[model samples]
Target: MRVFISGYYGFGNLGDEMLLDALRALLIEYGFRRDELVVLSASPKETEREHALSSFKRGNLLRLFAEIKRGDLLISGPGGLFQDSTGPWSPAFYASHAFLALLKGAKVLIYGQSLGPIKRRVNLLLVRFLLSKASLVVLRDESMSDMVPRNKLLFTPDPAFILSVGEVSGLRDGIGIVFRRWKWDLESLLRVLVKMGFPLTLISFQAEREREDGIRLSKMYGLPFLTPSNWAEALRVLSTFKLVIGMRLHSLIMSAMTFTPFIGISYDPKVRSLCELLKMPFLESPRETFAFSGYIRDIMIKWDRKSEGLKCEVEILREKVRSVFTRSLNLLLGREA
Candidate 1:
């Protein structure tokens, strides 16, 4: 069957790419052809690099409509798709885009996704309308479920659970710290980690970087700052890093999938969910506690203890993928429930 995916993909952000990665693999395993999978990405480069199937710019409405019309199934695969983390109308990006496919008469399935505590009335109504059109929907958290309609599509872990294949390594002496907005403190983190002899590779995922936010932090702790053009390269770079400290969900998710001893820096409820899945502990960014080096030292010790567990987690993840592919495929093909 021809399938199309729409979400915050195409950005070199690891979390977003992992979802796309996981969803595509599941469909293909269930017998979809590589040529049959399509994605709406922010840019074409991502489609070429990380995405194996056809890809397009998410902003191109006419193209999006055309792809959906051609697809047998349209999936808003995983991540916090329905939330407004970026803006008041952000839910529309996922909902409306997925809705376009539904309007085209595609079987719309929203799997491993999230609903939100809508900050606005319009967002809530928009969510209701968009979700009402879905053939299947699974909100990742219970609190989010109440805000969304009861389609019996209540919950699943983020698609990262299904996407993480494994960690590859070629670390080149420098570690990277990738973050989204409102997640890190630049100066204090630099001083503490660098003094402890940590090498540097600073990264950010905000579409626009605000130098002002990290003024004191960057100047005192001079580090190489960069951003990946999209996730395909990010994964390549991740393969080169010794470790990662990340605030965005995808960055951290990618690091874990690679088995890097990552320090997840967000306490957002969604973030907490991903961490729990891995049985990993995370810090609340720069403010969560003091004696930063000591905290990290302790976590490092625990990571060594739990490293074997990560291998086991990978096996469990693979099993879960087999089940989801079996179930979703059977339903899509009108087999027994």
Candidate 2:
């Protein structure tokens, strides 16, 4: 079976990359060979290098049409494909891709997709029309159910919940703080974390670090300066953290897979939604982040899943994921298993 996935595949975001990784694993289990899975990769070079298993194709209008027509099963999103409450380009663009794929007669499955505050009427109608014909719809949150009505819109948490952090060498036992989105106030937050005896590693993005803050943070805490451009290396650093206080969506999601404790600093509903699905505690308003040390300390005591036997919460999540994957795969294949 050819399983075509439309996501932020070419985008350098670590969360999107991790979600694709999880999707590939699930695809392997769902009967697609490694060669049969093709990604509409935005960064073809990064996708090719990091995702060595899957086939990569440039995600253009032509390539998009071609992939949809070619694949037997086209799963549009297990990433933040349809969310645009935060951005302008993504929601309509990705949803249109999914719509076109469905129009082309592909077994379009909205897997682990998060619905959003769509502003465009055209986009909304397009999505509604497309999703109405979906073989199966697996949404990530309860909030999405009100917006997108599907006969099979079964709820499953984000796929990242089931992800197991890979084996890596450089990961030391330290606290991971990913500051991709909160670049504006990251300095203050970093200072507070460092002041509280927490060693930090800033996950750099397109924005350059302020020279003053960099010097101050380095001098004060003597923390590690980790700048990973690729996703796998990012995960390596992510796995090293005993607990991750992450601002980026995927950073929190990735942390959850390691079974490490996560404190989410979210600017989007998708972030809160993802945390809710994983049953992870979130650090909501950044205005209150200086108080996070206490919150972390208290939670760590109760975040004792590994300290004891297998946690019941994790087991329940695992079963839910397996069921979603099974049901979605069966429905897409036109089989009632």
CA lDDT of each candidate?
0.67, 0.67
Candidate 1: lDDT of 68?
64
The clash number for model 2 is 2
State TM-scores per candidate.
0.80, 0.82
Q: What shift in Å separates residue 216 of candidate 1 from its native position after superposition?
A: 9.6
Which 10 residues in a row give candidate 1 its minimum summed lDDT? 207-216
- Per-residue alpha-carbon lDDT of candidate 2 for residues 113-181, written as tens digits (9 for 90 to 100): 777666777666666766677777888776556556656678786776566656733444557766654
Residue-level lDDT of model 1, residues 1-337, one tens digit each, is: 6787777776555566667777887777777889988787887775756666788787888887866664378878677767665588788877777778777878888787756646778887888877776777765556466645564454555556565443465444556777556735545666667767867777765545544444434565776666666555566666566667777777766666566656677547766666677777677667654655675676555755554566577567657656765676577668845
> Looking at candidate 2, what is the lDDT of residue 106?
72
Off by over 4 Å in 1: 44-52, 60-71, 140-143, 148-151, 161-167, 170-176, 195-197, 205-219, 224-243, 291-294
Error at 318, model 2, angstroms: 3.4
lDDT of 2: 0.67
